[model samples]
Target: MSHKEALPKAAFQYGVKMADGRKTRRTGVGKRDDKAKLDRELQKINQIIARRKAEAADGGGVGTPDYKRPRY
Candidate 1:
């Protein structure tokens, strides 16, 4: 299933940790938008995600990996 068709909300969040000990986050909302509008928002989110992925791959601002603690 396509993302837009599967997920009701188009908004998404992304975060990056700077090498200098700071964290940055990106988020958005299109809660009241119709399907077409939501699709556009999703496309925007996808594009931003792609760009961030490229930047991370290039080792731009992505610092050390963040490991998650295991649950008991």
Candidate 2:
């Protein structure tokens, strides 16, 4: 009979337990992708905050109401 090669193990393995008693798996995949995605999200949030601050400084913020309009 011909010899067979051993199968490789799984890329991910059981890691740790969660606070709710659930099991978790740890993997080395997609870490860089996740970091890139988080960085992009943070950049977008920062840009929006900066734009809002600039608008507030220019007195054109949404919180500023038109004084010419009569209040009900």
- Which structure among the candidates has the greatest TM-score? 2
- How high is each candidate's TM-score? 0.37, 0.46
lDDT of 1 by residue, 1-72 (tens): 556555333332222234444545323433534767878989999988888677668875455444532111
Global fold similarity of model 1 (TM-score): 0.37
Candidate 1 runs further than 4 Å off: 1-33, 61-72
Candidate 2 regions exceeding 4 Å error are: 1-29, 61-72
Per-residue CA lDDT of model 2 for 3-66, tens digit only, reads: 9966545412222234445534336647978999999999999988887677668776456577
Candidate models: Cα lDDT each: 0.55, 0.63
Highest-scoring model, lDDT? 2
In order, what is each prediction's RMSD in angstroms?
25.5, 11.4
Which residue pairs in candidate 2 have backbone atoms (N, alpha carbon, C) closer than 3 angstroms, thus clashing? none
